[model samples]
Target: MSDIQSYKQTPKYETFSYLPEMNADQVRRQIAYCIAQGWNPAVEHSEKENAFGHYWYMWKLPLFGEQSVDAVLAEIEACHREYPNQMVRFVAYDNYAQSQGMAFVVYRGR
Candidate 1:
């Protein structure tokens, strides 16, 4: 067996894990897409060590029927400020699909 092939890689967290960390504009665009789809926006946070865990603490209730991307971005910033040492994620819930349509880490823990 090849050692390189046998090496266990570290597990990555949610969406966009394989890609470079998103910049502010990219995050805003994603939130805008969610809003455009009429999905609800929600924020969640967790300790960096537990980011891969099944659950995270929701920042607040999901923002339903919110149209402005700025509002969602503001909420993300607020969560980041409140939990600077923890990972913060932005999630979009699709009511029609009955599940999360999109989710990604907005802020990595220090």
Candidate 2:
């Protein structure tokens, strides 16, 4: 977890707000499900201003070799705790291609 805390009550950065359908529980389970099949995982998010665009896709980090869904979920939860009102996401990457993977927001707001 980060020692620094953000009490801004909202994402000071850009983020997507239309993907609550992909909540934390779902994302965590989905990643676990995929990794059980031998896929990898990573995470990322956007600033507040970029949130709420239904058709927009947020930026993300590269697919790391880290396949621990628990750790990723922990990171996601920590991110939400640090930025309670911000947006956060998780990604599942398989051995398909470098730029091919699944991405979705896992946290909407506090």
TM-scores for all predictions: 0.89, 0.58
lDDT of 2 by residue, 1-110 (tens): 35333545434222222222544566667778867766667656655566655433333454467667787777767666767776676666667675435666676554
Clashes in predicted model 2:
8
List lDDT for all candidates, in order: 0.87, 0.59
Regions more than 4 Å wrong, model 2: 1-25, 52-63
Q: Candidate 1, residues 1-110: lDDT per residue as tens digits?
A: 23222124644677775566788889888998999999999999999988878999999899989999998889989999999999999999999999999999878888
lDDT, residue 97, model 1: 93
Index of the highest-TM-score prediction: 1
Least accurate 10 contiguous residues by lDDT in model 2:
11-20
